[model samples]
Target: MTGIASHPEIAATLALKRRGITLTLLTTAYFFSYMDRQILAILQELIRKDLLLSDTQLGLLAGFAFAIFYATLGIPVARLADRGNRVNIIAIALALWSLMTAVCGLAQNFAQLLAARIGVGVGEAGSSPPSHSIIADLYPPEKRAGAMGIYSLGVVLGTAFGTMIGGTVAHLYGWRVAMFTVGLPGIALAILVKLFVVEPPRGMSDAQIVAEGQDKGVIPPLGDGFRTMLASGPAFNLVMGVTITSLIGYGHAAFGPSFLQRSVGLSMIDVARYVAPVGAVCGTISAVGGGWLANKVAARYGLHAQAWLVLALKCIGLPLSFLFYASSNPYVAVPLYWVSLLFVSSYLGPSFALIQGLAPLRMRALWAAVTLLVINLVGLGLGPTAIGVISDLLRPAFGEDSLRYAMLTFAAATPWALWHYWRAGVLLKRAGA
Candidate 1:
């Protein structure tokens, strides 16, 4: 036989290997990014009690403070990712967010903790956009959905580990200790990423260069990114759909542990022990499965398949979410929550894959940043805060049941988001045709 390097099959296999390594490192970084973000949800009760704060204050801390910085800073960071070294950007960001997360453990007051959380957001701002751009370069359109689905597992795994580890550690030690434990590991992960992850050439996976005949050496103006995205109907609709979904998802997630503790009469330890695992498994199945199914469907049915799947999943999830919070028994409510999370979690991979597929290569990172800007600002920034305000409003009448009702009320908006997905799918189908 000829030398292994001279064989075409061997070269293809090696390329796949490099892609796998890049995806694995990026996904791991994503895991820590989300763990640091979601750990606060599990520990909110402890923080509130220790800090002597209200639910509304806790909501602001969980939602607005982090999201505002994350969303705003994402644009500039994404610009940097587009023009400079994405690997370096991600590594430095991972280190910054990880360090800030550790500093959260030292907070003795609300202001200090809030500041640290914002710092975490600022650091995490650099993570997803660059990662998305890199993944798009590594995988061609046909495989991107499945690859993105795998990457989206960071959401499920992060939430799972955050709840499991944070709750267990807080129960054993304290919330501060829990934060330190989860936070410090990411710094080392950052160093690993810098040392090992290789950056691919932009547009390497695309069938045609989006910037054909343009200077590959020069970065396009920032406004060019916005113009390109706004000019695309499907891209705009995808952003709207994702933002609304995020509002509902983040709101529910922010209050879910507390809801179980208060509504189902479970202790924090119990919520972590039973509910966390169920939610994690359900979310992982839905995210990975949805992406895989979408890719298979898209292979036959075309680009609209992903959007149609999202629409269907949202439609099914709406009633399930209502049922989950409405039920009083943990046995009944937990299963319902699992089903609801399954459907809702499916949206991330499909939505993200669609964004990358639709956006031009030069604009991919910026588009991702813009999508996140709206999602974080409206969804992450407003969802928890809205729940908090509504809960406080209903508290005088419903007492502890207020949060449950608040979450249920937010679930009503899921159908609204489904409409956008439907519209987006129709547009995508037309564009493909």
Candidate 2:
């Protein structure tokens, strides 16, 4: 027998060894997914200049066009995850997206680049929903926020690696090569996940007190789980809140590199070095710490954790958002942006964990996919495009300052998002969640 099979428990000191391994692989996979997606934002300045693209065109690529396919496909893929072998599907997606990323490096024109990005969108459509499903299967309710928080770390770390690497390489070699560099590594990692991460028993991460009362080894029907979430007011509110927040978040994502380039006069390489790492570190801290704190708060105050946490963070973040947009100094704006990211990044893990806790086992992927659909359609699909359109419209009058105002306008969406979270908190109590 192999070492793992021979020593089923592996090390005595390690607790929930299987869960640790599963989540690690899932997070790493997500790291590459985010890495490939984010590299473009870091390299935007170089790509825009070389392609001679308009802001509107860039926004379309970054926002609506990519997100349209990405969000639309997620549901079907998630439905497949509910019923089929998730690992094989995820591995295929990794390979497809990695190849598409490499293809992006080969584009010589705006149209070609747009098409390549769409390819990337199609490939990425397969990742998150299945991973969410898998996570719900591996860890228990109490551990989920921490687990998802660890998983959420991939967003910042991947962005850091992608941005820094893409920026530096683009600085040295050009943006094209940077695209290829960030994407190719995921192909290998996909194979590793398929080989090592076996699917755990469904609903293992649920409230085990409930699980213990039921018959062992029964996989709940996927439809039943979907209906559970569909009827959940708190869950629905949380999804909408996150989706709205994502709209503004994606706007920042679409134009942040360009903001630094036009406003701060940093070259692409400087963005990777100065901007990417800063956002990455802050974002990771916010995501992981937010989950940890949410759990701590929940233990004390119950489901009210996210409500208070989000309120405090948003109140602080709103001001930082203003500062981020108002400041012209990279030194000031960069750090301020990082601070804002800390708050924004914190939402994902806690929010996702909340959804997992609310929904039944089989439907976890479906609900995740459903949330992604709304977020991608409304948030990513419109945020960048709206900003771009507005910026272009303002350009004749405001000139270079147009982009700044457009970004500030999008930041206004945060308050509404905060309100939704607050409402979700109230509904959570009503639902007895």
For each candidate in turn, give its C-alpha RMSD to the true structure in angstroms: 3.7, 3.3
Kindly list the per-residue Cα lDDT of model 2 for residues 1-433, writing each as its tens digit.
Answer: 1333334244211224556776888899888887888788877767778889888988898889899999999988988887777777788998998989989999999889889999999999999999898887666666678788889888778877887888888888988888888888889988887787765545544546344755243445556555676688888888888898889888887787788777766667778777777777788889889888888887777775666577678778899989989899877887888788888788888888888777655577888888898999999899888988999999999888789889889988788888889888888877665
List where candidate 2 sits over 4 angstroms from the true fold.
1-16, 207-228
Candidate number achieving the greatest TM-score relative to the actual structure: 1
Relative to the true structure, how large is the alpha-carbon lDDT of every model? 0.88, 0.80
State TM-scores per candidate: 0.95, 0.92
Q: How do the residues 332-362 of candidate 1 rate in per-residue lDDT, one tens digit apiece?
A: 9988988888888888888999999887677
**Distance from true location, Cα of 35 in model 2, Å:** 1.4
Candidate 1 Cα outliers beyond 4 Å, as residue runs:
1-16, 210-215
Candidate 2's TM-score reads 0.92
- In model 1, what are the clashing residue pairs, if there are any? none
